[model samples]
Target: MEAGEHQAVQLCLESGALISTQQHDLSTPVHLACAQGAMDIVRLMFSRQPDQRGASMNATDKEGRTVILLAAARGAWKTVTALLRLDADLSVKDNLRRNLLHHIVLSGGLLDDFHGEINERLKDFGDLLNERDIQGCTAMHYASRNGQLKTIESLLHFGAIVNLKNNENQSPLHFAARYGRYNTVRHLLESKKGHLIINEMDGEGKTPLHIASQNGHTRVVHLLLVKGALLHRDHKGRTPLHYAVTNGFTHTMEQLLAVHSHLLDQSDRDGNTALHLAAMHNKANTASLLLSLSCKISHNEQDFTPIDYALHYKHSEVAMVMVTHPSRSEEVMSCRTKRYTCLVEGLTAVMPEVMMVKHSFQALQNTEGVGDIVPETDQPLPVMNIMVRYGREELLSHPLCVKYLETKWNSYGMYFHMLNLAVYTVFLSFLTTNAVQLMAEKTDRENFTQVTSAQLASAFVYPSTRAKYFLDIMNVLEWTLYISAGLMAAGHLSTAVVDRSNQYIMAALAVFLAWFNYLLYLQRFNRIGLYVVMFLEILSTLLKVMFVFSVLIIAFGLSFHILLAKIDMNVKTPVFDPFTGNVTMRSMNMSDKGFHNPVISLVRVGTMMLGELDFLGTYLRPMRALESSAWYQIVAATWFLVVFIVLMPILLMNLLIGLAVGDIETVRRNAQLKRLTMQVELHTDLERKLPRRILTMVDKTEVYVYPNQKGSSSYVSVPDTKHVFRVHSSYVLRD
Candidate 1:
């Protein structure tokens, strides 16, 4: 029967089952059976479920021990054999580095090296032989400790490191010697490689000889000594003789002394002899045996002798023997520093990447684009986050290549410029209209006071002021228009540079410039200029909102006609009609009918009439013809209505409003000055007259006077007279 309850174990096993009938702990039925050392149970479970036996044979148990290791530790050779056959990893170690080999070595089983059955069944003996346990010891160390010669030989033949050390720094040879395993020690020595046994020490800095001496193993000590083991000092500067005597190993001490009696008197690096250490350790018999070797005490170096050390440690009996002999003392040195220099270097090495990451984070916080985050490091997570946050494909394609293109079109000064222009334009328009009105009023004989009004208006004219206002308005308008045009052009250019197309942008800029010119014309033209102003205004508005191409065609036609007529007439084509064989009848017929042609035909008539008529008649005939034309009558009526009715009213209203605003501003300024003067007078009266009157009343009319000694005249005096004389009589002033 297994040690654990079968029902509880069965429930635990079932509760922990996973996929493929595997358990929660990565185990199977065979693992649990082998671990618990139940052979019959393992066979029964294997027979019931053959597939479960092969599930993760390398899986570890709850303690991180493999089932193979557990079976090895329990000496369940059959179970261990079964697990190894199932491909359980023999080299797998627990958390403590205790592999199956370590368990088997510690199990105290008698292993046979020459057994063919054992060798055939255990093919992994070589794997176990080379495996190291926790504290860096191998199975050979454990085998050597238990005096298992055959196991030691098997491990050695299969490449088990005989020189391997444990946590205590003791080799397998040291373990064998310390445990008095003579046969195992002989086997290790026989199979030892170069530098394997020499200079090997334990945790206490003791060679194998020291361990053999401390454990009272005379034969092992003799064996190590014969093999040329050094009688070296440990960390405490104590030799093997010291350890042997201190641990009460009289026979081991005798063996060491027989080899070298002078070794007892010899002091270690600390000037402490073997006798001193023995006396300190309170080994009376070992100390006496050392004292029989003619050991002497030196008085000068006897302070805090072994006797004193033993006495301080409450070993009084040992203290008596230590006081008989002592050795010299020595001093050791220490060196250390407080400043941390490496930290500064480490920070310097990482500074660039750190700064890049910080700047990237700050840039991302302010902007909206995913590609805004720059590539700073090769780390995948940060780059992946950037890609995911900002669409990866979009960022890669058409990356923010034109990030530096200028977007700012205008400055604060540009707006100020516009304001100045509007103000000056309005002011100049007002001045021009007022000047004309003044001249018209002066010419009207029926109007009374016309001269006086003219003089008054002239006095207030101030052409310099008018000019200043006009210049200011022009300055503002000119700069505002220029800046707006320039900005629109630049914006279009920048957009074109970024997008590689300027069609819409150029059209928009052209329209903007045309509109600006329209506004300028509106400001320049008043009543009489309206017909021309309206034409330009309508054309510009059409160009901006509707058909730019149509406007361009009209402009092109007019320019072409004007240019063609400006060419010299000396170089002429045939005047005669080729078909009729006479002078072109169409021109002669138009002249006979007296129907004047348009400007183009008029230009041709002027060319023919230039020498025929005098300059005066030529100009008069053209003028008369133009005046008598039907088109001229229609244009004249339209111009008259637009200029006199529509545009004149608007101009008149603007002039009246400007005059009214000026008058109101003048009145406001005068009132403000008047109020300031009154306030100053009131303050002066309160500061001087009121204070003097109140002081006189408080003094009750009493007066004080001071006389100048040289002139015998009173320079200061208070009023004593009841009546005061006036500079002039009030009646005389009224008359």
Candidate 2:
């Protein structure tokens, strides 16, 4: 029937092959034919079974549309007229109690084809025109939902109420706007004028504007705006502007915001403004627009900003927009920029997913806490912990991370830092004293025992995850210093005379190495810490530069040895026995420099690279009389000097100097940012040493402290210990 297969449908009816058959929808041949607008096929089926009239023709399928209703909906005019002539129940409603008009309007069909004849058929049936379906949607609702302008117009002309709401309380205009049916929306507004409920909200408290904006229907959104569809917030407290931003419709957002510009910065229930949604969704253009409006860095209830969302979601483009936003620092912030600002607040989600612990990002609110309340292993490792490990400047520089570290620092950080510094200093002092005793050819067994015990305690206290634990350079250095010191002590107790020198050598190694460990603790001061961090960064760059230019330095060094033969050797000394009257072996002095061999020649090149030109006074002061004066040799010597100077000092040295300057410049610009990052790491190391009682205290989960609070600012969580006691000072003690 749908294929206009009149012959096939007629044969099926005549043969009685499918006359008794029904489809999955229980749709018989005639019902299928009517739905497809195959009036001829429907007629043949009816002709074959004349007795199948009233009950058979009026019977509803699964969806409850009768044959006549379906035919009229499909514009099958002849089928509907025949059904009406057979006294078909025009007043009969579907399972949903929708009459013929509902289906006709929903599917866009001519309802008044036989209006003059049908008027008599339903003389007392004017109420059927306004009948409601099971969903309480009238014919007008369906018409608007289907975007049928003609049907909407005809219904309004026939006294159909325009603002009739469905079970969801969604009016005709609501359906029209939701489906982006601008034509019907315009017709409804034009037809009903003031009577049309343009601003009617659905069950979700969303107006047509919200729906249109969410679906990115810019035209429909404009039409609704012009038609007075008020920008309203839904149950989630999201405005139409929120919807526009979420869908990344910049133009639609522009249209909405232009009408009500003040809602641009208004936060919803979650404390998320239009800008937050834009950043979360990586809508760079939308973010740029929001930023252009001087949108401030408003923190959500979770204390996350738009840039936080951008960084957490790995939206670099969005982050760049927010970071470079002209008003980032200039725009007035909420409680953040105040000089007396206090932080009893912060959030967890910070860095991008690729940098996350599990390689997936989830907001703290969405992260399910472990063991009823303790935000333990299940949560993303504490934000500061992640910052220390992952090292995102954006995250580390965030005020929340900074505030957290500051709070920790001001609370008990100084005490913890001083305690550890005192312990390490004692150990260093012991190591130094033992090295000094060995250097003075003395013994101090008590000092040696103390140093060895500290080393053993350190190794034992370290986490058993050795691969990750030992990866720390400090850990490696600690083991080296302690083991060397122990070996030095062992040599002192031995009777072997040759072991004394080995002991001295080992003692020297331990003393100097202990100083390098002090660099790790240098982060306590921001000025020094930032330099240390920058120095590490610059050192990495320096290594690469040196590695690449090593060949040039060696080439020049070897050429120097070949070009100038006079500066050939470091020293020519001989070890001899006077009684034997013979020289045993030649000795080479290492504390001297000249292009004697490849190694010393390369050393000369390295010295020249560092701007140490010894030849200026020794060789070049007065052109030494050449043993074999040749002009070519003179030219070679002069030209090689110039080439080495150009490559090493002028080019390579400046490059190295310029690289350091550039790093210094960057550090200068982001000095505060770098200090904040360093503080986070320092505090992380400090916090890790804290007891579980301290870690658990605060908001019954993670410990938080307000350094500036009037009273005791820490919210301590009483651990689930069997026996616990509180002292007069409110200090908690547990077994």
Please write out the lDDT profile of model 2 over residues 1-735, one tens digit for every residue.
Answer: 557787877776667654435678867667877667676666576678776644467667787777877777677777777667767777777777878787667656755565754576655345666788999999888888888776666667667887777899888888887788988878877774534477778899998888888888889888877777766678999999998899888888888877888888988999998888998999978888887777666888888767666655667556545444545522422234221241111112332211111211223123343334433443323555555556566775543444455455656665666666667777777778777777676666676678777656544542334265578776788778878878876775663732877887888887777887767666565456566666666777799989999999888887867765443323335677889898865433222447657788888788777778766443442244333453355457667888888878999988988887766767554554655655655554545555657754621222333221235321111123112211111110111
The residue-by-residue lDDT of candidate 1 on 1-735, one tens digit each, is 246456655555556543124367755555667767776666555555556554545556666776777787778887776665556666677887887767877887555522454466456666667566667788888888899887776766666777867778888888888799987777777675625675577888888777888889999888877877887778877778877877898888889989987776777666777766765677867766665666653211444344434434455344333322222111000101112233122222432221111112223223234344644332212332454345443231211100100000021212322444455444333333332443342322222133223323432322223344346553455444444333333332344432323423432443454345445434322222333334443444444532433342343234323322222212122366679788642221123211133344433333322222132322323333443343344344334334433322354435434544445544443333222222222222222333445433432211111111123221111123212211211111221
User: What TM-score fits each model?
Assistant: 0.39, 0.42
* Local accuracy by lDDT, each model: 0.49, 0.65
> How far in Å is the alpha carbon of 144 misplaced in model 1?
1.1
Model 1 segments more than 4 A misplaced: 1-29, 35-37, 110-125, 192-195, 299-302, 310-314, 319-735
Tell me the lDDT of model 1 at 220.
Answer: 87
Lowest lDDT block of 10, candidate 1: 400-409
- Residue 347 alpha-carbon offset, candidate 2, angstroms: 14
The clash count for each model shown is 3, 1
